[model samples]
Target: MSHEQLKRTALNNAHRQLGARMIDFGGWDMPVTYAGTIDEHMAVRTGAGLFDVSHMGEIEVRGAQALALVQHITTNDASKLQIGQAQYAGLTTPQGTFVDDLLVHKLSDEHYFLCVNASNTDKDFQWIVDNTKEFDAEVENTSGKYTQIALQGPRALEILQPFTNVDLGAIKYYWFANGTIDGVPAIIARTGYTGEDGFELYIDPNASEQIWNGLLEAGKPVGIQPCGLAARNTLRLEAKMALYGNDIDDTTTVYEADLAWIVKLNKGDFIGRDALARQKEQGLTRKLVGFEMIERGIGRDHYPILIAGQQVSQVSSGSPAPYLKKNIGLAYLPMSHVAIGSQFQIDVRGKLTAAQVVATPFYKRSA
Candidate 1:
């Protein structure tokens, strides 16, 4: 999409004022970097980095049949979730591939909140609506009601504590509490895309700039920087977090993507449960694997995978992981080639570059 026609987040002005380099991201005009990708990336690793994730979509399901509706669409078991808890789930199609990977939050006995990928918001909302015909639930696309921000890094808690009334220490991972941040009502969750101890805050659009500025001011002592999409990409890549359009999509199954952990076969008659069960029974032919470049080239998306100079699969997501200081990437390959320490080749610009399957999560926070 063109820049002029792209949608802007609530923080669009804030990012421009900070001299961020803006770019088109999934039809949204977003900041790609502030100081630079590498600099912003390192700041999040050592200190704290703020991100405007307001473009992500939110859907609300409310009524007596909310849990039933959620369980019918998502691969994860919604019944396993308690009030105030959240679970990672995949909204799957009848054919067993993902419509989108999302976070399902149990707000109450009869209320649920779904955080979906920015690009798949409308599609997901419609999918939920179409499936709700059998259940007595109300599905609303609440994407515009709030703006989201992520405060990530080692010092994230220290920077965010002063602005909220709730005790930051009490909120466990994957759990959230509605509280006031800088006197603005918000949903504060101890969840993040970066592999660090951090929090993602969902606040009213009108209050986003205030909260963003507040974080920057409060975090100044700890060297906080406003990061952008570029840094976010590298950070998540190093952490082995899947990017919806790249690492996974409608063509990839959860089991084939190495995300079987999110699938609960006992979830009971989900949209793709039967298809997934059959796939499991037959065993998987292809599997997603992580690799580091053995040659001095950076492998990228759509790059063909080869074994002994013959094509086998293709790279899905690849980047030079700044924190790990290595060229790390993920790809789908034959199960025989998915084993750790196994060697393969990636065609980088028509040149066969050596790469090897490596243990994922190239970077992990120190305990």
Candidate 2:
């Protein structure tokens, strides 16, 4: 798509003002770097990093059968969620493949808020709407109404605490509270993609630029960097958080992706419950696993994976983990070689490079 055809977020100008290098990420013109990926990456680890995630999508489900609609389409047990809590979930297809991975937030007994991937927003909205036909729920694509910003890293709380009246400490992980930041109404959720102690704020779009700037100013004392997507990608890789199109996609089932934890079979029927149950019984042919470059090379996305010189799988998401200071990636490997310490080779530019399976969630924050 042409640059002119790409969508722009509300914080577009704010990013440009800081001399951000913009890139075309899934039809949206987004910042890829500001002070550079390594600098931004390390900032989020040691201090804090503010990210303009306004490109993400938000959908609202309400009315009498809202919970019913949520339970039917998503794999997580929404019935167990309280009004202020959130849970990670998969929007699956009847064939047991991912439509998208999303965050489901319970706003009230009759209302649920969902955050979907940016590129799949329209399709997911349509899917949600189509599924709601069987229930008495009203679905709204409210993606345009909010700006999503993520403040992540160890010092996140210290930097964001002064701006919001939400009592950031009170909101535990995956929980959210309705509050105001700098007098702007917002939903402060203690969630993040970086696997750090941080918050994702869903706020009014009109106040996006203000919030973005104010946070930067407030965070300046602690050396908070305005991070872009490249840093975001590397950070997520280190944490082993699945990226929708890269790590998990329409053709990949939750089991194959090694994300079966999101599937609650006892929660009763969902979009892909039967297929998943069968997959569980039959066992997996191949499943996703983490690997580290054994040789001095970086495996990139879509690079061929060779077992005994025969290509079988492709690297799903690969990068040099900035925090770990090592090259790592995720890929689907046959069950015979899925165990940690199993070896394989990655065809990086026609040269086969050695790699080995490793324990996933390559990095974890201290509790």
Tens-place lDDT per residue, model 1, 153-216, is 9999989998999999898989999999999999998888988889999999999999999999
State in Å the error of residue 84, model 2: 0.5
List ranges where model 2 is wrong by over 4 Å.
none
Provide TM-scores for the models: 0.98, 0.99
Pairs clashing within candidate 1: none
TM-score of 1: 0.98
Clashing pairs in 2: none
Q: What C-alpha lDDT do the candidate models reach, one value each?
A: 0.92, 0.94
Worst 10 residues of 2 by lDDT: 128-137
Name the lDDT of candidate 2: 0.94
Clashes of 1: 0
